[model samples]
Target: MKKKHHRVALFAATGVAALLAPAALRAQESGAIQLEQIDVSGGPAQARTAGATAEKGAVGPIDARQLLPADLQTFAGSASRVSSQDLANQRPLTTHDALRNVPGAATVSDDGYGRHSGISLRGSPFRRSRKVLVMEDGVPINFSTYLDAGTHYTPPMDRLESIDVLKGPLVNYGPLNNHGVVNFRNLSPFGPKETVFSAGVGSTEGADQRVNNTRHAHTRQTFDNVGVVLSYSGLNAGGSWDAERLGYDDFYGALGIRGDNQDLTVSGGYFRQRDRYDEDNFSGTLADFKKYRHDKKRAAEAGHFPVSCGRCYEWNTYNADYFRAQVAHNLHIDSKTTLSTRIYGNHHDRARFYVSDDSDNPPSDFVMEGRDRLYRNYGADSRIEFADLPLFGGVTHTVQAGLRYEEHFFDNKNRLGSTNERLDFGNRGSLDGKQKLTAQSFAGFAQTAIQITPTFSVVPGVRLERYKISFRDFDEPGNDGHSTYVQALPMLSFAWEVAPTTTLYGGYHRGLSPHIVRDVLDTDTGYIAPKKEIGDNLQIGVRTKAVRGLTFDGAYFHSDIRNYQFGEAFQSNLGDRVFSSLDKARFDGVELSARLDSRAFTNSPWNVYGEGVYTFVNSKIVRGTADGGVNVAGNEVPESMKHTANLTLGVEHDSGLDASLSWTYRGSFYTDALNLPMNPLDVEEGKVKGVWLLSARASYKVTKELTAWVSGQNLTNEFYVSDRSDGAKPGVGRTVMGGLTLKFH
Candidate 1:
């Protein structure tokens, strides 16, 4: 083994010398000239001759091009961008993998697949990602952005070109931006014409086996001034847990028309998913979990508990369909002025049929519960931007203002039936409960960038929002109610260039999250209402490229939340949770991100690169009472981990050989505001232990048009508890996969 290691090192050194010798000699013969920086935003700025709007209105306000590693100092706030090249190099199996290394972002709910998991930002709670604003192509994607705000669907990874994470004082994309925003950018239809296909398959090695398959195709073309794009992605897999099956397919299309001074784009897509997974059997008591971690079906047998027999447990299933459409138009009215508008609509239908045995006693008959839900949403936004306008005393200003209107409706129904019945359409049980919610909102915002001097700028903005929501409970007519609210939120941010490659930036904003329909008027108590969340957020950060081949970004943030909300689960049953609020809560933290590349220092064929992110948060409930009227003051906030970190190190050669090894760590946190210790029953109110995972991937370009790759996750085969929403649940075990890609023009 020692001799083999030495030989490998010698071979790498020889290859590096052979590839760098000519470049080194050329630099000596003539003065070295660096290449011009490439714009990485992949937005209109790259494809259009007219100067694109800095904040491109409804399409997206933040420009990702300023987030390049070498140009981080140009951005005015804490932000990061994962480019198309980064995604191709990572080849992530789930969205968690793709976002693991981003500062201030955390994935708490894995769900084995990335489809419906939670993505938390900063100090927000990670359950269902309720506190973060998620967008795709600059449009909201939550189940009901104004009524429910629970994310249930996400676009497939194969169809995306990049992801942008913007943190701190989000004044342009509100209503739910208490923490920050995450935007998923689709591949532009205006890019070069090409066709690409990808296929892969793999399996896990363990007591419970899981098989995986993936296929995707994308095509783009243009004729004269018209451009078109079509894409599809499909997945079939045996999920992480036993007796679990998952499958989904996504289809998208886009058409673009470009004229001398204006452009129009129309895009739409459909996504369908079906999965057979026993929701009740996914978790169990602590003793049962430790003894039979992988044997979810047989866990109850250990305690001599009568368990649901063979087919009874397999009745649980989930089905969902999403239909979306949007139109965006940009008009260059003049050299320094532009107007943009976006209109979008979507319809989502989802149903879950799960076997339930929630009786307190040991023996009970299994019953099927069907939860059906539907949502419809429509919105239109328009904005105008004026750039480089002279105001007074040699001061220039860039101003942007917009107006938005939105309407949303949600319908939910619950039904119960015997397990022996044939659940054909999953909506066939007797109606037991029903609810309907509707909301309409109107908002306006204006922000101006005042260039006080050449090296410093100050941005001031304010948003006025008004919304009305109504809720109706069919089973209980007394629970019907309606409410209206209006808010004026203001923000201020500044950026100062202290050096050629260093920037100091900070901001302050007022954040708000309106009460959901159910929370606005609690059905459990006809007239009891929970207050909405209001927070005062402050942040300061620095970005520097002082080192030759390294870029570093660090920030400190603090948030004071009034009427902070949290949820608690029942100890004895599943699907029984309650939401409550505290008078005041506080969260303060620091986030650090750094990246290093050897290629930045020298023109070497074999380059080494490393990147990492670390976060530290201190959260506390200043004033609150538990369900039993216990004072919970000074206790740590639930689901707020104190520490989390991720690191990746890799090597790339000009020959198209790339490999990377990553390590991710998630710190321990409590499940309730009381910060209760572990109990034998293994209920949700307890401390969850921390865990670390290791993953490795390598890919080689066999030819110009073809590439091959393989990856392994959880390489240590670590068996650990992932989450405790209902009870202790096991994380994904070790898995390996390999794949190939083909591209042509």
Candidate 2:
């Protein structure tokens, strides 16, 4: 380990020792207490689940067929959880690998570092992860949901307690509820007061033996009433085939406290990372990709590390600061009714400096671009849940209603090089233009769970939202616009207990995705602004634990998309052109997942799990354009994948040794609405080929406080392509990493 990392680790470890000593001494004085242990082999089949870590509920852990309030569990929809222990074991270097198990999710990275990773859900556009609602403990992280939602800030997964994934029409949640929700919940301060720490060092190697090293350290402490968690992670890495040198330094710190009836938490993060845009596809003709298949290092290697190498400097730097404060209070108001109120404020500042990619005129004087942006969002939310409400027609009802007021402001400044060409970016560029947006939103929602019988329940929900936006263009005052949209979203769902261990659920809801300032404002050409995206979502699924030791959740989903538009490259038998936006698409998909614990079934310490998602997009262009492009009806949807799946099988011993093998498949996706190459000058395949990879991990617990683990990624070293939009960026190559974990409780 480098001295830099050692200093970081030592600093955190010293704090841990200082805190734990006193806590341990006091516990000993008061008589030590320990958690109960469930012996898997000696108990009945049902007892196996007592300590088993499987799916998690919104507030607590849950069993497969258990019943919970809609707010406490995912009802009439699909959801999943990944625990903190799982993240520690994998030590995933990229966000794509961290979310691989989530069905109907596809991730693309310009570089393996996940600096600006894009997460596409159910055929959402593969741009910045704009469509998905990203929240840390239900608080927004990006700038503005409707002004500048696209982002470059993602908290490292290592600091999370668990990740909650909900896929469906979240009619009960406001803001961007159309696509889906992926909430990364941070660890809270509760239970025993102690400290936990994890540190690791590893490396990844490509087919030609090129390697990139990685190092990370995490520490968390829980005092009696106050808790603190600090994390510092750094990565010095390079790409497999692209050879893009990258460096990253991220710091996160949060202070939280819990009381009997009130809890307050505050957290903030800062990071600076060098981005390596591997635009190798723009290097040469199609034959170049095939000729240098094994050894292909392109323009990305020019300016990342510098070292006096005056190759057209393309170094891109991104910096961001994130801070959020949340306060919550619970009032009993009686034994059967409770009122919970939460208020939070979030502030973000981000900037990106880089050379814009010009595929048509590469190797010439490139355009230097600077993107500076600001985002501020604050909101207050209050909800009251009645455990027992008035009954109607001999049915029981548990109702909850909430009101929220949210406000946000955003600013974007773009600067371009003076001559459309620049060698050194030290010279300030010309201000191309600036855009500003102000938004205010008020929302209220009510939902009720009516238990018709002991075995069946029905839920109905409704939400009213009033949103207004003001957009101003600095250069063109005439292009300024003010838009206000008021609408009501509704949902109806049902759950039936078909058997003791099987529950069937289905729901239908109207999902809405709000439009941002860029998508809502008119251009200088008098172009009509695109409307917000809407989807009528329907889903049906069954969660079963009928078979002892086996848990399965299978579902079928369909989304009717309307008025959703995005930039797309289109090419048919006719000439090729890139449209500003494409519209009117539909997506249909199905997912199946299962998990098994062998100990419950055969008295053996083994487990197996797998999940698969297949989405079919019947996308078409309902509107036409005067531009000579393929926006005609019946055209294929751009950047939509037909199939994607993941499977895993693993085994764990009672003595704490475990091993797992996983495989992921990404199907070929079209790059244009016409489903053909967009390069009319040289017609080629427009689809980025599918990629298949195998990953394996093995870990052994040598003692109560020490564990060793090793991870293998892309073991087969498969030569595959990931994205073909601007250029072909290849998939991650083969790599191996190992590390140790230390814990004291």
Candidate 3:
């Protein structure tokens, strides 16, 4: 009977959303970096082909890391970006690897392959990146972000042109942009039939680490008014743990039609991956981990996990597929007013097969636990911008407004498996329990930049959002209800261009987040009654080119977070993993950074360059955990890094030779809210210590179209822990790779 209800609900929601949704409306400049000669008034250019670069003026684009501070826009707060050049310079292989230059971003990689990444901002919990809005271009990358928000998939960096990281929601972006927004901008399509191809292989000195290969290709074509672009990236490699492996492939395709007064872009993506998840650990005591901290001779001598001896070599297998589509249109309404509309849909399926170490049970019996999760969502995001308006002063107001309407669905089945036929609902493999959750949202926002003076501007914005969700538990017919959330957020900020090359910025905003649906144990309270989180974000910063060769951006922020949420892991009645919630917390931090190019100070083709970022976070438990005995009001929040710093120094010669060295440091952090040590030295697998990693790279251009490079990570062979959960997760050790690329123009 419940199955019948689930099908009906899912079909109805999907049908309506599909019919009305078009794709993401990528206005020319909502929050993207502006390329030289491109009209900043226009949103992302539709005329540009996919994978095209700014060098061609057709919108391929560059990253933030490639821009000088003088080129950055004067927003209320700092927005950081990483360019394709920076990515290539570092020879990145994972999402985290590509983002290594961004400040204040903490990528807590459980295992170094980046199958599962923890990106936290302002000291938010590192799991699932619940506080950050991760997007591709202008569309949400995760299906039903409010439902199962995890790092299920991250588009390969090789096919991307730039990545933009903004704090809070942009006026044109849909809803739920409280903490931060990270958007992966793909390479735009270039016209005249252009193709770009590249490939490389890497090896790491760690247990089970193997030589991995990464390949990517992009092509663009234009015929009269229509343009098309297709790009793909694939990876075949070993997981960062013992006896593990991984495979991933993804593609992005788009079609654009440019007209005299209007333009349209339709884009789609599909991603697939298979990974081995090994959780073999000793988890015994501090002394035990100490014995293996420097042991790289082989896979550890032994493990203390609760699994059979022979079966201990096993682990879970994860498989996932994600699909997304978007249609964006821009209308230049007589130059002064422009309209942009985007309709998008995303659907995904993920499953994990559990393998146990039970000697008494047969291999077939060991695979009795499994998880299947599904998500579907479609919506329209619309925005209209008035380039210049008559407000307090003539031609001084740049105003914009947007609206979003979306429908979403989530379904999951985790049970004792009776057969290998999983994921599909057919027979459902001895379903122990099932849940079908659905939601719909309507959001609206408006903002205007009031130029109070030639060198100063005040921007004020507001976003209103409302959502209704239905939660149904198939096992218990009565355990279901409707959860509703509504929020009106207001923001005001100012940017003062005090000098020719300096801008002072500051802002205060009210933040809002929907009441999330949690997968909790039956014993957990407020499972269905989770409340929406609310907080205040305040920041002040500066962007300046004070010296001929030096540029810097710095900021300090404070947040009074209220009714926030934290997950507490627990075992359910069926021995399944579940999470309950912790009610309130507070996070505040400081971020500082600087960049330099010697050409400005000394007119020479032989140049020196340097950049660095440092962050300090002070997070605390305000309302404490749900458990009655624990009073953690004054303690530091779990996994809140005390300090993090990164620096890079390099030299570039006119001869086409470049070399750079980078250092990354992370301060110690507690594993849990208890603020207690798990090791005899006051730290253990559950309490992570500080870490420092060194990296270096050099590349030489044989010709303008061909380049050769060599790179190394953890060059010092540093030994450190990344994650200290049930067991320790080691950081990526020394790795070296050499590759050559040839580009035909």
Candidate 4:
């Protein structure tokens, strides 16, 4: 490892030297070239042509281009904005933690570290994740089975460069855009002149220790026109709660080749996590305890009775590997047309382990415990575009179309242990089981934006999708079902420059999401069915540089979900079985944001920027059934917070130093779906309350070759629970981390 590190360092230094030598010679000949003059709020060309507008608008109004990563967007569009900086400010370790500030969004967790976090969008709960498409660089990451479970096991946060979240049915991108879409773009190859390395360690609850290390290097001359980036991270921590301990490791790398007018990029990565934790039983109610106090005491003394010995421990593990490759060709089909095409493929594998045990001792008799599962996916995608259409009003239009194909496989196994002499029971036969699932889907979509006027435009688009599924099991007779679904998702949006510094926009769209095998499969009865989801979304917003050194954007949105999916507990002689069904829901919300950027803050060392956001949401289950009974007509949805807010202030200096402070708040919420009184014995209900968190970070450059930074999260040491299924367990506490970076160039 030491030798490899040394070689990488040497190669980085050599590449940097090669780039600087030529630039230094050119600088000596030029002698102090002048700097370009332009407005900071808008691009150079726009600033030069719209000087009046620039003066009217804020000094540095939020730029849409800045909201997205440098290489991701094709053109500056609407002001709906969120950025990587915002995510970093939140210090999110899971996707649920990251979406806390977004409107109409909430998260539920069955385990920490994203092991089983479920995302609810626009009031839809427990629906097949296929309803919400997840993509990496325009390629679908959800397997052919159309489920988001992969995220719980193989979260891509460690390798993400940025995340772009689009709310509502966004058909323009492709099929499977029903509830919404989250697009994750990976970090690109760095320049030859840069190298970065960092390491940090911290402690959590229950004597848990967390440590991580990362390295990034950009080489410009490794293969004439090639550049590469490699990164690796490992995390291990003991549980803050009894019997909770977990560890994970991840690796990622990318290589790219740049030609005079074209680019090719290839990347691959892997992640693994192992966890062990105790499970708590929810049936130990206070009434039962009061009634059985005497019996419980006697049982405890004898050590033979189960005093709610809800003390079962569990072990879980997950592993995943993925590979992707993309190529882009820039060409001029003719003097009037320019075209670009991107083609890519992805492959992923996953495995999981689960174990449960009761009391301090293994069962004296035959014990039932352990489960194992495996999954794999493969897919390919392509996109092509034609620009500069010669037609009505000298308009320019872009048409995009693509196709995707995927396959999935799954396997499951169960284990039972032999009985002990004390139980006088014989060993039970072990059960080996396996199941396979396969699915195929195809979609084609197109959109056109016509320049109706110099300052106005209209975009109209539609998409068509067809899908099928098949299943087989080796252990028992497997069931298979096939259904064809077609949806015409239509969208129309308009943008008008009301004034040089202001813009107004509004649009309505139709969206669809397909159900997953889990949603349709009956684990207890071996029954299968197909489910579909649809919704209508409407939004209106205005953005403007209302004053000097300030920019403001706000919007109001309403989404009505039809045939939404929710869980129903079925009572049987054996036990209770949970199943998925269609339910109606409505989600309405308002979002507002403001940003200030100025160099006028008391002669600060660097530019100063401040931002704030507030969101109000109302979510409810309009119609549904639970446990074979009608649901209340006006019940609020579980895990939906009424209000959320965020604020941040920061400064970045030219001297390679930066600092910032951020605060976040979430309103109180009810944990149960029925909204009934929580069991008195359940500590989780009693612990519910609103929460506030504060964090601060700063970094300083020691020299051109070295840098160091420190961050203090949850500075106030606030104790709060992010979620509680039955009883309350506090979320993470105050954490502090410090790290140093070394640059080879």
Please list the C-alpha lDDT of all candidates, in the order they appear.
0.71, 0.59, 0.64, 0.49
Runs of candidate 2 exceeding 4 Å displacement? 1-74, 88-91, 191-194, 206-219, 240-243, 277-284, 293-310, 356-367, 417-430, 519-529, 569-583, 606-631, 677-685
Best by lDDT: 1
Tell me the deviation in Å of residue 104 in model 4: 5.6
lDDT of 4 by residue, 1-745 (tens): 3453344334333432332211000011111111122233542233221111111211111111012223211122322323455544444555555664554454544444444435654444422243456566555666543432334443435445556556632454544454456665555553343345555555443323344222233222235556666767665554434345566666667776654333345666665555553223223444543333213223223332222222223223333444544443222222222233344444554444322334234332223434444555544433333333435665544444444444444444444434321110122225446556555566666655455665665667676666665665555564444556667778776656677656676576777666555446655666465666666777777667746777776667777767655433221221322444437667787777777887653566668888776767687777766444757557765555667677878887879777878787755565545655444664334224567778677777789877677766567866555555423444555656666666575
Which regions in candidate 1 have their CA more than 4 angstroms from the true location? 1-72, 205-210, 281-287, 300-307, 358-366, 424-427, 519-525, 573-575, 680-684
Alpha-carbon RMSD to native, per candidate: 12.2, 9.3, 6.2, 9.8
Consecutive 10-residue window with the lowest summed lDDT within model 4: 22-31
The candidate that achieves the highest TM-score relative to the unseen native structure: 1
Give me the displacement of residue 605 in model 4, in angstroms: 2.2
Error of 2 at 474 (Å): 1.4
What is the Å distance of residue 479 in model 3 from its true position? 2.1
Q: What is the lDDT of candidate 4?
A: 0.49
CA shift at 48, candidate 4, in angstroms? 18
31-80 per-residue lDDT for model 2 (tens digits): 11111223336534332121111121111111111112223233546665
Q: For candidate 3, write residues 385-443 as lDDT tens digits.
A: 55545566443666667677777888877856543332222333566678898887878
Better of 1 and 3 by TM-score: 1
Can you write out model 1's per-residue Cα lDDT over 1-745, one digit (the tens) per residue?
Answer: 3453344334333432332211100000111111122233643342311123332211123222111222345555677777778888998887777888888888864455667657878867777777877888778888776788877677888888777787756577777777887878776666677788999888654323356888999997778767788999998765545555677899999887766545567899999888765445334456666676556556544431224443444456778889998877655555555566667789999888866554233234556678888998877777666666778997877777777778888988887776445343545588879999888888888887777876787888898888887888898888987778888889888878889778888888888877556655655778444466888989999888988999888999999988888766444432455576878889999999998999998888999999899988898999998777889999988878888899999999999999999998877887778888866565334887788889999999999999998988788978776766655656767777889989887
Clashing pairs in 4: 59-549, 684-727, 684-728
